[model samples]
Target: MAGGRLSWAGLLKWSLSYVDGAGPSGAVSEEERRWLAEAVERHMMVDVVSRMREIALLMSTPPAVLEAQGITHDDIEDLLSELQVHVESIDMANDLHSVGGLVPVIKYLRNSNARIRAKAADVVTTVVQNNPTSQQLVMEASGFEPLLSNFRSDPDLTARIKALGALSSLIRNNKPGVSAFRLANGYTGLRDALNSESARFQRKALSLTHYLLSESHSDCSVFAQLGFPHLMMRLASSDDSGVREAALGGLLELARDTTLGNRSLLAEHDRLRRLLRGRMESIRTMTPEDLDAAREERQLVDSLWITCYHEPSMLRNEGLLVLPGEESFEQPPDVAGRFFEPMRRAAARRAPPVEGSDPGDGTGGGIVLLLGLAPDGRSNSPSH
Candidate 1:
């Protein structure tokens, strides 16, 4: 009975004696408890280290063996997700490389299960995000190829997006990673993503494109070679505002390129000017919430406009930047007036027809905010 029964007497005795004092009760003092906590924490961290290595070994195990052990994609995903959380700490991120977790995580980018592949990319993303040490290690492991593979052709949208995100982090500040991307035709893959139906997918690709272009001013011509100018224009007009902004940002970076090749491509030529002009004129219908959200979009549009047209935005033209009621440094009047106003007035004097608008509307190259012309147009432009 004692050996096999519930042992209720023993449990009662243990519970009653469990008080925090050095008495018959098996309770330790505060100092002893603190010491115990320190030891427990150290042991817990040790366990974490062991668990990380174990997960890494399990991930490196062949899929066939894992399947035989009844480990499914979901199981692998959960394991990776946990590893990813651990890898967010910079120490743990470096520790992951030390423990050989990073490579296997990269390897799983080619895992048969779509969700597992995506989660593996997620782990890679976490590992390499701002960690140059891990970033270099990842590139050395030839992690880039599988990531590129998933980003280019993974059937799962999430997998593609996550893989793109991982690749982005991998190459961020690593010049060799960037060179590898160029050699591996990462931009072409990004172009494919831009054409994807997923808005987030397109946005991530756009951001990465902008970064890559920013890193190498010469890449703008690569984009023009890829016909990305026209593609970017289409994306800039996307119904999704984020997609539109990302695309516009990419275009702005293209416009800033001073390379002879970019100049030959004529990114800042009439077509872009007309596109920006039409976009500037179209913002009249945005609700306040939309306008607030779209300020960055408008700013990108404004910058791209001025870059191509060599004049300030309509905001500057309207004296909003110059004649602000309060003295603020947000828009310095000297910078605004010296470079922008004279050109705007000079353009106004000529009063050219808007390139993309109806030829006979007589609205001029810029938006006309004439009273009683359109009820909503005038009010929407000046408030911000």
Candidate 2:
């Protein structure tokens, strides 16, 4: 009978192994991480609200054992962060079946101390990055707009850092639905960060600019109007490669449209014309709206092509041959053929493509190339 009882306890312990497993991969195994995500989801359905509360209590508790079997307080912190992410993912997954009580759980998310708050920000980020619908749900459940005030105005540096992190997450994740105040905050915060003494702050600011430029291609025109050209020139030549790359990428996004592309920003347009002929011929005919909708998709495809085509050794190894589209070897071919599926899938569901639409109808099917020269006078490829 004692053996039987011990066997039952062992089974329970085995089943609960996942409770302590989810963490940074450099700290835990891939299988453990996957199992933890699944187990956390299962446990959420069992007694999710209470389980989270129990974790909160445990987070405040001391560790009694350092044995191999039981979890430590540090482990709890890591696992709590992971569970927080899982809970947010569940909330964001748009499953109507989650317990209604999950409403309070999200409210609880914004309650932790600075370190925990940063962890919460990361959880919010995962939701925002992966699922838009969840972002709306999180906004509704947590009054995340008001939470922004705490993150921004907190006197503590830790609090401020957490808030900045959260703001970046919010900015990146909530695109079409972001409020005007959020945009205003981003403009203010990013502008200030640009002037910050700390290089870390400056890097984050650059990243924010990249995210904004890449996702909100519509706003590129405003940048030029606001003298972003000078700012971008400085950034492109910054000591930091990341900053330079981001500035270049943002400029690329902006120059896709006629209003921006036709400007002096694209001084290397002739080189781009030669390199990107077939690749971006469709972009020449794009309406401004089409350019906006397809900017991110095009960036991804362009990155892939650059990776494949730029390295001669890789090209030969892959047995890939480049066929010039014209006798003059003028432009790249309609590489759009390679990108057709991704474009078709990315076509906005609510915004139907117009009938008999041209390449730039913003409905779909085209590529835009933006070319700029480096200060050294070395020309970049169309893919760049």
Candidate 3:
């Protein structure tokens, strides 16, 4: 096993034994554990790279050649699905893009076959998500127009969902893509999705709207003009916790907008004020178990209420009463701290070494690491 191919069945047996305190000579050494870890990683990487190569070849092949080979559209859809599975890795996404795979994938967004279009959207979504280079490439390829068209007019709900997801991935943290999306009237489709009867569609739409507003002030303004704030306020009280959370998140983003117009619009919504006050009162009366179960919603609503309080003129305009020195909201007592405090203290029992002393070697002088932290927490240095 050490020098040859590793089988999943063999690995599973070894892992079970290791967990059950059964190893070679009845004990597992650190060397054995490290070797197992490395073997598992190598095995996984080999499988992934092999599959990625196949998909890339298929993507780059000419359509006529594929036809001559008896590869139908269904086969291509299956390959695209496989590509989607692998594209969660940044290297796979980059490889796909480098092999001229992206253009055909974007063209498939308008494929007559619904399954192919959905799979293509899934592939695009997986490729562009959290990947800035892929996002920029998709935007430069004019990918937004097809995606928006499908998002607006696709008869298949599943395809529409995938298209909306792909659009979200394209616009996330990409300003140029957002501008293109807005110019193409993408917001109208999003608004329709938000108002749809399907909670799943509404949730995805709200999540995308949250990302849009969070990235671009112009998007927030456009959404506000489309009465997104009112829609969010209505959804904030939704029976579906997920929907409520998404709506509140969007509302919170809108409230935090630095532009006075966005803030003022939220402030002037009478329904929003009433919703905030009503949720606050309900939360104040809830039992501990209920609060614990609804902790995320409670936190979001609390944050929204506090935001309202911070905006003074907005509150005053609503004729909401407030007392001086009453702006602070008390946090719930940290009940879990009583159980964890001793563990934390035990972990911190060792005193800190002198500032100039190296903990690694007991050498004098601290190390000055010149590392620039990027948004993703990766080092920004060229060597990185």
Best by TM-score: 1
Tell me the number of clashing residue pairs for each predicted model.
0, 9, 0
Tell me the tens digit of each residue's lDDT in model 2 across 133-219. Answer: 665666666546544654455554555555566566655556543454346554555555555454565566667666766666666
lDDT of 1: 0.78
Candidate 3 off by > 4 Å: 1-50, 57-74, 281-287, 309-384
Error of 3 at 22 (Å): 8.9
Off by over 4 Å in 2: 1-50, 53-82, 88-113, 150-161, 171-176, 181-185, 198-200, 225-228, 260-262, 265-384
Worst 10 residues of 1 by lDDT: 1-10
**CA shift of 129, model 2, Å:** 3.2
Model 2 residue 94 lDDT score: 51
Spell out the clash pairs found in candidate 1: none
Candidate 3 achieves a global lDDT of 0.78
Order the candidate numbers by TM-score, best to worst.
1, 3, 2
Error of 2 at 35 (Å): 16
Instruction: Tell me model 2's lDDT, rounded to 2 decimals.
Output: 0.50
C-alpha TM-score for every candidate = 0.72, 0.47, 0.66
lDDT of 1 at 74: 84
